[model samples]
Target chain A: MALLTVQDLTMHYRTKLGGVHAVDGVSFAMAEGEAIGLVGESGCGKTSVAMALLRLLPDNAQILGGEILFEGRDLVKLSEHEMRKVRWRSISMVFQAAMNSLNPVYRVGQQIIEAIQQHLSVSEREARSRVAEHYNLVGLDPKLMDRYPHEYSGGMKQRAVIAMALACSPKLIIADEPTTALDVIVQDRILRRINEVRAEFNMAMMYISHDIAVIAEVAERIGVMYAGWIVEMADTVSVFKHPAHPYTIALMSAFPSIKGDKRVLAQLPGEPPNLLAPPSGCRFHPRCPHATAECVDEAPRLEEIDKGHFVSCWHPQRRSQ
Target chain B: MLRFVGGRLVQIAITFFLFLTVVFFLFQAMPGDYTKQFIMNPRIPPAAREALKVRLGLTDSVWGQYVNYVRNVFTGNLGLSFEHYPREVWDVIKERLPRTAILFLVASVMAFVWGFPLGRYIAWKRGQTLDYTITVAGVLFYTIFTPLLALMLLFVFANQLGWFRTGGFLTPRLWLTPPSSPQSIFIWLAATLAGLGTWAVLARFATRRIGHPRPRRLAQRGLVVVGVGLAGLGWWASGLGPFAWDIVWHMFLPVLAVTLIAFGGDMLLMRDSMLEVIREDYITTAKAKGLPDKVVRDRHAARTALLPLVTSFTLSIGFVVSGGIVTETMFSWKGMGLTYLNALLIQDYPMAMGCLIFTGILVLVAHLVADLLYAVLDPRIVY
Candidate 1:
């Protein structure tokens, strides 16, 4: 069994206006020690899917039907108390906006130490030592642990958050938009650091990013999401080389340089549909150039297209007799 | 600025005129004039009462009486007090005003001296046991304990302790011998104010990190420690000594009663403000560096949280200056509350109205001071 398996995971947010199908029937799995990417636009349900696996959705959010299995155990049925024990030790999350995720009134060292102490039986000094060790591991000065958050720059704050996430040495670290706020150089440095840490610790990671190039730079496998559903999934190099879904094709066409081709970029037509009232049938049919009459009436099911590659479309290709 | 002041000056003029008209009608609406209470005596005839009413202008129109009252008020002539017969409203107010001002002035000074730092401490240390304990105690005080506590203080010091005068500001001896000059009166004021000033100076300098004479600095720090230690001693001081103790003894209950009310609110507000500031993103950056809670709270959170409190402090002064009628009555200190209440009870309407105007002006001046402080404290808050 894979380290984590998500099957038929559907989540919606019940807002005043209407039900927003944020995470609509998304499903994926991650093998142990393997990294994966969940890539989509700003309002896509990528974040919702991540939060649902952790069962940390807000009050208005509902997990209508889903099964999340971690280490062959169903995480969907775990009690809050049981989940708390597993959070830092088994599955930890480094939230977006590192500045807001970390509490400001405490020293960075204390915050990391708090996560460690909460998860393990350790003395204050032991926790401090561990925090100092992580500081070195993340390439931050251990002595700077006593400094407050305001003294650090934006990139440093993100690094501190990453260090705090890795302090407990969890099996999986779900980094949601970890480097989106950083400058290009800083983002590259952070990605390189994360890649280095993954190799050293041999830890599995789920990297979410809006940029496909950034995701390809760090993530081993990629899943292209469109309108709360995964449209393509394959090995990173193959997915970059031969895109299947129209949305993924548009993304690849728009940024051919990420595939080592410096061609003129052709941007996609129109914006993503508002999730509150998504179109019936295939949600992306409105924007799909290959849409026929069948695509308008019947939604597409994800199917294997080639070895270790999945594509979701009603009229996928000439070979799909 | 001149135009704004000009407008306010016009407002003050119109308000004063309208106030006189209202006071004139409201007082005449009483069952009868001061002489009517005497009419209930069996010997007084109907013709004699009517004669008294005509002489007193009881039959004049309300507007006519208002004009006469306004004329008298402007000419430094406050009408005679009904209760004291010939004593003008100014004389009665002058006699009582000092007692009220001194008590509240002392109370305000005491509250700020201790309360500011204490409130700031609790705010900076929010969600800790000390903060929680103070908050719980404050909620208990404002919601449940204050009135009962006020009564208990009145009883314990009044009935059981024969140490100090139960109520009133000065000894009968001092009241009988009026000071001949403003210098003597000012001296009395200085003597009354000596203790708090000395304590404040000691606190301010001792808390400073700057240069001082080495020995003086050490001595000052020692004094800070000892003075803080001597809270019980100072508290006990209120119950000992002859005439001096009587002032402290009587004043303590009222001051204590008012302090409990004001401090509880100030502490609660400060704590909430500090907590809100701590949640800001900048605070998180500060924390990531491993700074101590005190540095985070005092240097970061407190500096921001104190912006609103400058305004709150002025409003609190207004509340204190108004004087708690019950606290003053319990202390029997003859402050404004007691003076105002005594006048209202006797239907000495003009004297009562004058007291109201005096308090109204004081509260307005305090609010004006708050507006000035707002511009100084928060640059974003433009006048």
Candidate 2:
């Protein structure tokens, strides 16, 4: 069985403007120890998928329809108490903006200890020792754990946050743009450390980021999201070499590859369609360069286009190398 | 931290000096002096009136008086009161300080204790019926006229139900039959409070270092119980329980009126602050950690939310010590506000200036304490 499966997940945020369809029919499956990346532009529901899996959404967010199956159990049916037990112990998250993820007032070590003591029957000493171990694993000094978030540099804070995420030894870690707030050097170091940690533990990771380059470094498989829909999903090599959905194709072209011929990075025109009133059919129809009459009228289902590859487009591009 | 405090103290001293100078000139600019009454009385001849002005130091150059005022203030001599002849200005102010301090300080603390949790709860339940109801009610009480609220509470609780005294800080009958006067009782009260505050602080500091959770918790509870028992025994042994109860009984109506007027503002502030804090990314991180909602709200969200409330509470205590004018007048509470008003009404410059100076010192100290507390409460704030 897969380690986690999210099927037909639909989540909407009840705003004053209207019901914001943040995550519409989003589906994906991750095998044990597989690292999958959810890559999208800002406001494209990448973070929402991460939030939905853990049921850690805001007050206004309504999970209308979904089955978050983790470890062969349907998580959507679990009570909040049961879900809480599942969270951090089974599936923890490294939230975006590590700068603000740790509470400023608390000692960083105490916060990690709090999480440890909550789910496990550990003595304070034991938790502290575990926190120290995680700190070392994340390439931070064990002594720095006693310091407040403000006392640490931005890179150190992110490293501390990563340590916190790893403290519980969770089976799955949903890292939502974990390196978005750090400088390039720190981001690269943190990503390399995350990959190393994942390999050591053989833990599944769901990496969420708008930057494909960042995702490419860590995720084994890639899911390209747009307007609350996953436009394409494939193994990292397949998605990079033969991206089927036009949106994914455009996203691939938008980046500069050092190995490729010198070519101008293509800018995808227009903003993402507002989720509150997204286009009727394929949410990406308005922005798709190859949007057709059928694509304009009918929403496409995520279909198996190849062995273990999925694309949700009426006219899936079959680009030959 | 010591350097920060030292810098703050120096700043306060300068501000206080400027404040005293302003007070002196403002009082000096008044149309007439306390000797004006004697000047109109023909029975008191012009020579007697002139002697009175000279004795009161009223017959000096404005500059000379200013210099004399500054010098006297520095030496802790507030001079003699004009209206209450032969009484030192400091003595008069000292007599009223405890009354205002006890009543308003107790009321303000009660307001905060009651308001903070309510505000946190309402904010945590934002947009719900309970939140709306509390916000509406809190805003109503907060904006109500102080005198009107005081009078209404007095009329209902004091007059109609007879649950408490209608006005005054102490029962006149209780003091009449006493070897222990109100002054002695106030002194005892002050000492007892100071002792308890120190004990609590020390206990907290000592208990914080305990390693084992169970023993640490037991120690905390044991400390509290012992402290309470000691305070009770002390009160009973002193034979002042009845007098203290009488004072407390008399304090009820005014404290309630003031608390009702003030707690709502605190509640509203706490609610707003909590709202802002709950939106912070750390709160979401706490939730994502699988901690229960209550723990996330209080431990993570409310801790940061309490930052603004701390500054407001400390600063307000400085101003609140001045006592409420309308509340004091309506309740007939002989507090600092009333005393200051009476002195100004009679144009008693020394007494008024003394009151203003005391208030200025309190406000300056409160601001310094607020800054210091911010550094303590928020690790991000380095002194």
Number of clashes recorded per candidate: 21, 0
Please write out the lDDT profile of model 2 over residues B1-383, one tens digit for every residue: 89988988888899888888888898888999887767667799988988988988888999999998899889989999998888888887778888888778778888998999999999999999999999999999999988888878988998899888888878887778876778778778867766876787788789999978789988987997899789879888878888877877777788888888779989999999999998889988898888998899889999999999999989987886455667788888888888888888878888888888878988998999899899989998997
Candidate 2 residue A186 C-alpha distance from true site, Å: 2.3
For model 2, the local distance difference test gives 0.89
lDDT of 2 by residue, A1-321 (tens): 799989999999999999999999999999999999999999999998898888888889999997989999998789999999998999998888888989999999999999999999999999999999999999999999889888999989988988999989999999999998888988999999999999899899999999999999889999999999998999999998899999988888888888957888898998899888999899888888898899889999999999989999999999942
User: Candidate 1, which CAPRI tier?
Assistant: incorrect
Q: Write the per-residue lDDT of candidate 1 for residues B166-282, one digit (tens) a residue.
A: 566656664454434332443354454665467858676665765455766777777766765575365456532244444555567777777766666666667677778766644
Predicted candidate 1 versus true structure: per-residue lDDT over A1-321, tens digit per residue: 589999988888999899998887788889888999989898788888877766667657888887998988787888766776677678777777886766544566777776787678899999998888888887899998887766788888888888987887888888899988989999889889988998899889999988888899888899999989998898898787777788888887776554453667888888998899988888899898988888888878888888888888876543210
Candidate 1 wrongly placed segments (more than 4 Å): A256-263, A317-321, B1-319, B322-383
DockQ of 2: 0.83
Q: Given candidate 2, what's the lDDT at residue A42?
A: 94
